[model samples]
Target: MLVYVVATALAVLFTYISVVYDKTLKDSLQKSRYVYLKPRIDVWQKLTLYVLRVASVLPLVLVAGFRYKVGTDWGNYLRSFRSVTHGKDGHYGEKGYRFIQKFVAFFTSNYIWLFLLCAIIFAGFYFVGIYKMSINPPLSVALIVATSIYFSFLNGMRQGLAQAILFFSLRYVFKRDWKRFLIFVLLASSFHKSSLVFLIVYILYGFKIDIKRIIFYIVIFGMVGLAGGQLVKYVVMKTKYAHYYMSAFADGGFEWLWFFISTAILVVMCCYYENGQKSELKGQFNVLLWMQMISVIFCLISATVPESNRIVWMFNIGQILSLPILISLEKDKRWRLVLLVLILGFYMLATYIAIRGGSHRVLPYRMSFGGE
Candidate 1:
């Protein structure tokens, strides 16, 4: 117990320092030491870049590995895979039996290595996307993205991996690069079909985000809540996601209201920066608007709603990282400090809840594959 608390506190502090370093460290070095991804960057620059990343990432790696090593969910995931393949049902009823049996056979050959490969792939997508599009470079974003407690501990590997691609796909979305964005979305959906929600999200900028629009979304949310169960039932009976409605709708996951609070915060933030807002915040405002809608609608519809929280979190991850970064880029020190507190506070609460969890298996990262 003490171990988890101390480790989480240290992780949070270390992340704060790493982000500060990323902002200021450039002034101390020549241009050669700063650029890492550019092919034409000098050898000295590349080496320095690697050293910097190593310095920041090494500790995060150690802590993250600890979480994974203590991971209980991975074992269950393997069990679900085993059952689904052997003609037995898995934990999630009948949601993904066919899909799991198809590709997850790779797990039998070398599951651990495959997991590692996925972790690395997610890391690459996270760092490049956040850094390239964001004002902060990749190192800082890499440090932040690595500490995804849901990704590392709750065993949200599939969603984690999908969100990584979503992180990258946002660039294409911004560019209206529909082809590339669709390609990325297809890849993400292969990891976890729920990421198909982002399909609606990808083009959300088409609608402006404002108070009137926010009210409109709230109205839509209420309407969906009214009609949720039947709509879900219809879709489930008709489509592959039929199984999705089974556990997800049955779960009655009202706990996912954290997304509602986050949505409220985002609306406030958008209003705060309305005239003075940065472009990224405006973009993220639209993004949050989409996420909030997706989360609320899904929760309303699911019969049980077992995975609704996880899906809400799928949306939360984008809001948490992108909104604060945009706030940081606002050049208002006061807003920066406040945003820092909220980000730190939110993750700390998440870590503590997960650690103290009574039914700890319920963590978002631990995807159960009860393939009915």
Candidate 2:
């Protein structure tokens, strides 16, 4: 637990430095009259950004990659890796992850290679996604880490990978490049079949959400929740998850914390929209609002369908990015600080609850490189 706390704090601190230094470098370049010095400035900027990016994620990658008998599914993933090495068919996870396992096993039977590869992909996409799309990358990184998305990666590697890909693919959604967006969604689903739910994101991309539409969507999805169990069960029975149908049909407890957090983020977004800060990114903001609302709806559905919360994870990227952007949108300095402290405090408290409550068994951190 101390390890996680220290690592996360260091990650956020490095990210803060990276964001601030990047701006400083840009300003320095603009103020310089030396034409020949522009090339040097650009090189320095790139090098610093790259170095800090690696620094921010390095601790997490090392912790996750070297972990042994950690994470609830640690043994399960090990067995799967060994299974792939032995030329047996996959008995767990989706085809894409299994294919990668087989490809790695062809070169070496060591499960460390597979685990390390997954750790890199998970951390890489998470950092790159925020760096590319967020208006305030430091706050974005802090919020995402605090929300437990980063820690959950250790427990659900396949779903974590899928969610990472989907989060990074938000670039295409913001750009309105449907071809690229669809391609990435398909890739994510190949890692975890549950990721197919993200296809609905492209449909929601064009919507301009207002209070009335928000209420309408809530009511409609609320009705879906009333029968979500049977609907989800019927769908699971037709898929590879059929064996888990009984469990899926059982009621999954409501994720009240996430629901409240997302609702708070959505309210902030609505305030930003009402204030009429109509930048070119406003369209993207609208898309994120729709996604955040959908995240809340999935949380509601989880009251009946046990598996629907994974869909909430898919939409979490929206809330993660939206809050930081809203912070950037706030023109008043005092209000901005207040909003930042409130949101950060909320998410950090969530992290505290998760760690103390032992969600995912991510306590008493352990590490090992040797195999069974």
Candidate 3:
């Protein structure tokens, strides 16, 4: 627990310093040819940013990759790695991840290499995405730590890698480049079938939302929720690739009150931002708002169908960017600081509950390096 706290603090501090230096460079270069040619940073700033980036990424990689008997899926992943090493079939149609495991197993029998490679991929894409899309990079990194989405890197390895890759699609999304966006979506889906649902984000990117559409979606989601596990059961039964997850219906006790509260907060934030700001990032906010709404619907459905939360998680990942973007929308310095404090406070509370919560399966951290 102390280790986790220290790692989290160091991540926030390094990322904050990096963002501060980056913003200074951007601000100073506004009128220079360097701004138009490239984001020219002085040698010192470049070195500082690179060091900070490493500081921000290394601990997460170490913790996620070296952990032993940690995370709910640790045993499952270990079995799969061993199976692949023995030339046996593993993974349920997630060929991309299976191939990675097999390739790593060829070089080393230990599954630690698999975890390390996945962590590198996850961190590379995740950090680059946050750097590219966020108006406030430090806040975005803090949110990831606070929300404990980092746990997904340690547990849901396949989905974590897929989600990180999908994060890159946001660039194509805002540019309206359908071909590029679809390519990334398809690639992500190859890692985790659930990621296929994120393809809808391309369509929702530029969609104009109004009261009527909101009400219509709410009604549709309500109807699906009322169907309980039946709807999800039917879908799973029909989809050959997902049939393995059919047993998830046996325990239909997904609680989504937290998601509901989060959705309400997002709705209010979006409304406030739309009424006030005319920033370039408004389009990005719109895309995030629509995704959040979709996430809310999935969360509602998950209340009845436990397996639906996988889909909810895919969409909820947007909050890493959305929440920070929302906070950045505040123009007044005082109000912005206030909002930042409130957000950090709420996230800290959420992180505490997550670590203590049964479903998160993230407590009592154990590492292979420690002889666990």
User: Best-fitting candidate, measured by lDDT?
Assistant: 2
Worst 10 residues of 1 by lDDT: 362-371
- The lDDT per prediction is 0.54, 0.80, 0.75
Per-residue lDDT of 215-273 in model 3, one digit per residue for the tens? Answer: 47866876767575576667766776364455644465654544745666566665665
Across 210-239, the per-residue lDDT of candidate 2 in tens digits comes to 665786888797787767678767887898
Model 2: weakest 10-residue lDDT segment is 33-42
Between 1 and 3, whose TM-score is larger? 3
Choose 1 or 2, whichever is better by TM-score: 2
**Model 3, CA-based lDDT:** 0.75
For residues 179-298, what per-residue lDDT tens digits would candidate 1 score against the true structure?
A: 999999888887778778778767676876555565676668657655665665676668765665554345554554354455555555555545434454566556655665565555
TM for every model, in the order presented, reads 0.70, 0.92, 0.88
Q: Using lDDT, rank the candidates from best to worst.
A: 2, 3, 1
Superposed model 3: Cα runs more than 4 Å off: 26-48, 211-216, 238-249, 370-372
The TM-score between candidate 3 and the true structure equals 0.88
- Would you give me the overall lDDT of model 2? 0.80
The candidate that achieves the highest TM-score relative to the unseen native structure: 2
